[model samples]
Target chain A: MTENGFDTSCGASSGTRILVIEDEDTITEFLKTGLKYEGYQVTIAKDGVTGVDCAREMEPDLIILDIMLPDKDGFEVCRRIRRRDSDVPILMLTAKKEISDKVKGLDVGADDYLTKPFSFEELLARIRALLRRSGRAVDSTELRVVDIVLNTETREVYKGGKKVSLTPTEFSLLELFMRHPRRVFTRETLLNRIWGYDYAGDTNIVDVHISHLRDKIGDKPPCLIRTHYGVGYAFYPGEGK
Target chain B: MWKKLSLRTRLTILYAGLLALLLTILGVTFFIDTRNLLIENTASHIRATAKPIIEHWLYGENLSSQAIEGTKKKPDSKYLKKISRQLARDLTSRNVVAIVLDKNGKVIANGKVLEEEPAPVSPNPFYYRRAFSGENEVTYILSTDNKNVLVLLIPLRSAPGSDHVLGVVQLSSPLTPVERILYRHGLTLAVGTLITLILGTALGLLLISSALSELRHMIATCQSITEGRMDQRVHLPQRSDEVGQLAQAFNRMVERLEASFSAQRRFVASAAHELRTPLTALRGSLEVLMRGAQDDPATVAHLCHGMYREVLRLSKLCEELLDLAKLEISENVQKEKVVLKEFVNEFEEQARVLSQEREISILEGPSVSLKADPNMLKQILFDLLQNALQHTGRNGRIALGWKLGDNGVDIWVEDNGHGILAEDLPHIFEPFYQGKKVSECGEHHKGSGLGLTLVKAMVEAHGGSIEVRSEVNRGTTFLIKLPFE
Candidate 1:
């Protein structure tokens, strides 16, 4: 009810609201500060019953719900929110980093998930991406890194104006890496980001997708994605410094 | 049957038999020689008694040829009878029977014709011839009565230049007394031999049985050991014999076996417990997540996520457990020449991908080579790398490098993050041990605690060893020494 809605500073448009349903005041405050920094208006609901009421009243552009709540759990809150608003994006926050919890969140209509003790930067990024996918924010049609370009809406990719064929998994991985170029991403982080939080495979799935991305991008001077030994994978436009 | 007897018993019996055989031979020889000596002695006595009488007559110490002619008249015959009677009495006491034979071989003066008539000798001319030749003779024969006897003959001689021949005076003595003495000697030899044989056999059996008993006990103990009662021991009589020494050696061998078995059991039980604890924790966590707080989507999701992470941990634990077990059971790891540079590169790449949240680097020279099991070496590197990543916080740097050592390759994995505590470093390789320093890394950083344990197992399985050096808050370095082919 306060003016300027929660402490967002990125100048989001009116009606671009984020509902934060968390019982823990510390986590709520943290999320409130981080999401506000990323310029999304956030509303706090201390418990599941209040969280459901806030979701119905505000019809939030995005819902950041905590799994452990006082009255009703986040799953029920998410399910009830889905009953009224099927198109709104929901991001679930859970203390337990379990696949079954992720599946339950997904079953109750959460669009994405972030585990507790997570970095604020990652949480903000996931929220923005989910919002963008749900048409809650101004749609950025194309994502680009140097000569490589990916159009998320059209599901098309191009390398220096040449059309490149990529599997869905490869496109998602490239999109993730391209969104945060020059940042090192481990296979586990890449898996969680591109393959959803519930993916339970060899983690070699990320390697295979990266290999496929490299193949589609073609073998040439200064590969876009560079491998860091004993670290992770990173995207570099030219020779890595 | 001989195999049933111990070696000691067999040897003793052989020795005793040989001794008894020798003694029996000596006894038989002595008995035979003594009997012959008795017979010879009786013959000499007969000849000695007859020789003097014959000599006196021949030398003219008694009546000559005129006396012999007068013997045909009654008065002269009476005088001759008195002299002959006196000579007969002396001869009779000397065990000699004498008779005077005429030129026609008729008995003339027979002395001592008692109740029993003397057995006649066959009139073989051999005796007469022997007498005429004036040679005293001795012989041994079975007479017509079938009695073993010795005979002696002496000739009667008249005075010198006298053309008359005197009747033959023969001294005869029965050889029965000589036979009696020989029989007595034979009896003594037989009894002595029998006593000697009995004593020898008894002593031999006593000595042999004592040795055999010891041997039998040893054989029984050996049989019991072979029957799988390894605890059974030989109770040897406390003798300083060879058998006693052998029993002591056998007992020492069994003691060694018992110690080995006990050690093996302890190892197996410890390994089982290490594997079971993690699985039970994982299972309990999953059960809690499954049945509790289903209505709260957020709580369910959180619990499910926890369960999932636990499952991941459990899976990792299972993998490490299996790896450790394989290393423990595999006596010899298959070896191959590995290009160390390529292997390290591959390991670095994999570790980087797994630890992408951190800054890790590989620093090593190009293309080192070593002979080892490629899989085991990789496993060791993997475990060390994983352990480093788990302990290192975000943005921390880990360095992996290797160098050639004198006898093998020395590889090191080091991290600049929070290092292990000095107190816990020693027991880091112990299964399920999470160092106090490492425990503070974070919940996710807490591994199954089997990484270093598996690393140690793999390293040792490949006949190599791992060393750890750490300073609290400084960093940790793990050095692996792998021998070259």
Candidate 2:
């Protein structure tokens, strides 16, 4: 096994190799068609044991593991893989939407989980985000929209080349808005992205932190983060007057 | 058979029947005694007047002419005759017969015989023979014609010097007058008894019908309330009685039931609201990842991490919800003798395996024994351990230990991690409550805030209690108490 496990570090050159460990032939075929259409080398495994063996031998770039398998469960397979490797980035496919199942997957070292009947667009975006985080893909590392620049690596921000002081929380909030420029994000979405999964607290915490971030970023003619009425905040520099 | 009749009807019938029976006995006894007394008095008066007249005739025989002249001139015969007529009238009035018979059984005179057949001989005919033997006798009978009669026979004797025997002077009077009066009395008694029975029956029916109508109304009202229209109330008549009190009690019960139902509904809605927010984010994130992972391996890796974190949050929320449901239902937790020491060791081993990537070590203490539901205990420990692992930074050590407590057993999960703030400690077991320090953790490590809540619920389900002692930025210890066998 490679350093990141399953040889997922080849970036876009080695034709994104994906291992589909699914019990259902129809879902496996469907996934194969979609991945193949996007220039991926797709391999299918009918059960957990084969999936694990195939993963070890082939060292695929990614593993799409179904939670229900004939010989072994997805949780056990994920734990077995994590026992020898740390950074393989395993994506779990589960038919159950129960929170206990999701927790089990993560607790066993699976990188992520997806309930069944998912859209293709969502699967692709997640893959891009994972690849980007691992530094194995060519993507825009620094988020830049007009005069604003965000260094994801150093967790720093600059407006018009002037250093802006921000709390760790504020810096992350600014980066989230900059990553998806011109898209509206509600308070709940911002909380989830910055504060992690299911962090139940005062929702006004978002508003409070947003104001603090604005103060540190300094006053500009058109605000850096614009609030959409009764919705959420958005990042757009030039268009809004 | 008695159970079939209502208590009220049965009691009324018994009371009225006993009263009528007593009255009938009293009336019969009184009528008999009064008729006997009247007959005895009439016979004594006749004997007193006739005795003196016969005595004077027998002793003054030599001067009988002078005596007769004296009686005529002074008119004593008219007075005597008037007195005799009165004695005859008295016998007729009381429906009794007066007879005067001589020693030879000859009748001297009769009192208004009224052409009726001579009174039938008394069943005690010896009483008439005794009167002829010079002793007075009174006898009672029903004559051949069905008339009730009383007979008083008196013997008349001459003066000592006279040798000729005076013939028996017998007075026989019809007893129909007294019989007629008694018959009228009996008729009156029957009519009175019938009227009393009729009145009692009518009153009893009226009272029972009224009571039954009220009871039916109450039953109908109760049925309506049971059918889910709890707003309905029993309207008891304005009386200070048992039925009114029952209505009051029923109303109070309905009030309590309505309050509890409404409270339950509110709790469910609030719980839904708490769960919806996390689920939506998790769904949105996973959707983005599923679309196109093949084209870019780097993007696939990043999205996988995001989805993993979301799943963790969702699972935590779900566990909290399950625990809440169990608590609400008061599920009976199965109990067995558990080796506490061994159980803690197993839990620590599991925790160590999970946190292997994080550089955390879970330490255990010596074994202890306690009686509890093994499954519920494990769940409580699992939740506590997860909370510890999440809050603990890398290289932080968590310890699982237990000791024999006075009441039962105390299991502790102490972690050298960022503990809860004082303000947040009180609300740690409330669903969806996160502390102030949550902003410190990155998006992936932050929790769903339901872990401790689930732990508390699971512990309580096992008939145990849990307490947390923590110092912010230092460490926290969760103490669980379970009963010992």
Candidate 3:
């Protein structure tokens, strides 16, 4: 899919397509707007019936399904999709606690499932992992911004030859900054790019995650990942420790 | 101890014991009657045999001359001794003992076929004294040999039918034949009573077992039900006996329990489903605002307002949930004296505000006064009218009416609009039940699905009932009956 003439976050087209089958209008709108911003072509089906029909026709790279629907449930839709295309990764969304476990018990072969009230960042991480596992995401594997090295494939971040642990949101924020080193991003852009419709009343989730990332990789004095005054953040590699 | 016994055992004992008592009483009476009859027959037979001997031989001898000749002519004792031995010898074949007493109350002679020792006749026995008075004396004694002996005395007359001062003749006959008959009769009575008791006991056990077999089957069915087989039934074929009725009642109880339990389970599932949708919307709208929409005032305002609506819906659902919990625990209804016309007038004021574009009217009725909880009654009207407004088209005609009935006051709400589907009418009051498709009803028409459920609960809490009538595309009506205290 890299044949497209658009530059994605992966430095090429990386034209990955995703299908979201959900009955809720608000959720569908949120997912569509955020996913399009992430450089992924998104298709929305308002119900399980149309979703099954779309799966047969378009053959998307990944499928995000909601467990409860008007005509058919998420499990039935997953089974119908798997009947034709077995390898397409399906991530189910369940509103109920018991039905989340039933995603596997029903043996519909869902690749993974997310309970409702999940943050958009977690959803994005799961989607990327599924796309990468299915060999649909052609993005670069390893990144190096000066002395720090990060592997997107293994999800390992190393600073000065020492392993550094990061939360999924922190890792995504770091990946975006390192991908475009020396370029600044605004708070809004940072929030939208990494968090992707992640809900919070605080409005400073990005700053919190950034500081935590800085702390873990020993960039607490803010020299490596530098912040511009009214802008957002940029990766400036140095012996800031 | 009797109370501790099984029903079958008690019934059998009562049945057999009664029979045994009746048979014993009948047996004793029959034995006494037959013994007396045998004794009377033996006495008559002895008198029949003795009369001829006393008149012919004993009377014609020495005692005949003393008749018409008075007491001064006491028959010679020497003459009495001669005839008495022959008289005793004459009765040897009759199993009789003979004795002769002279007019002076002296025993002159007594002989043969009697006790092993010559009989110990008193010198002046009561029979000898009764004989001197010219009266015949009769009595019975148990002989030394254990036989019944009847004693007979006759006044020896000078002529036929003559009362005279003459010597007396006495005869004692053993009653072995009557005793033999009595023994045979008693044996038959005893054996007959024993056989009847044995047969009655066996038959009583059979009847008792047959009568209680259905009850035993019921016990077995109850055990199976306790083991959680809700579908188990006694399966009796319309027997109208007590056990049959019990089985029917038991089956009905289990069915109701199973139905209500499944209803509870469905309510929980649908409650979770209903709650999730609003929460999802709230989350989605908030996320959209926090992510990027905050920069644009228009989008920020739109998302915030949408989030508010979602929050309202969630809070409304939570309130209904709490009301349902309260309905289960609160049996004490707040009592207030209410007049129907006044109550409806106050309700119609609220109803008009709620009707919006719909046409609302009130039907005039009697001012029926009753004791009830006012807030709960108001909530009932609130929910019912709200339900009606949601299902009806714009400008739909709505009517509220009341009737004072003999039992209670009936308040009804009728709406002329898109009525409930016939299939959904039965479940419309069930918790979280959706009457029609939400899409057809419009976005705002989507309900928390607990309105009618709450209405019904409140109605029941007032010691009242609610019923609904609907036609698919014509109209719907809900009737509430609040009984007078």
**DockQ of all candidate complexes:** 0.01, 0.04, 0.28
> Which CAPRI level is candidate 2?
incorrect
Cα lDDT tens digits for candidate 3, B151-233: 66666664456676557766666566667887888898889999999999999999789778878888898899889887788
Candidate 3's iRMSD: 3.5
Q: Model 2 chain B, TM?
A: 0.46
Look at candidate 1 and tell me the lDDT of residue B63.
Answer: 49
CA shift at B124, candidate 3, in angstroms?
13
Please, what are the lDDT tens digits per residue for candidate 2 over residues A60-162?
7677888867557899888877776677778998766679999999899877887765655457567667656765454454666566667767877887899
Worst 10 residues of 1 chain A by lDDT: A1-10
Question: What digit string (tens of lDDT, one per residue) describes model 2 on residues B10-75?
Answer: 766776777678777877787787666555555566456555554543333333544555453221
Q: Top TM-score: which candidate number?
A: 3
Real A-B contacts recovered, model 3: 0.27
Candidate 2 segments exceeding 4 Å error:
A1-241, B1-96, B100-227, B230-275, B286-304, B312-332, B338-371, B377-485
TM-score of each: 0.37, 0.37, 0.73
Q: Write the per-residue lDDT of candidate 3 for residues A82-161, one digit (tens) a residue.
A: 99999999998887778546646248889988777777667877887787688777555776665567888799999889
Q: Tell me the lDDT of candidate 2.
A: 0.64
lDDT of 3: 0.75
- Residue A221 alpha-carbon offset, candidate 1, angstroms: 74
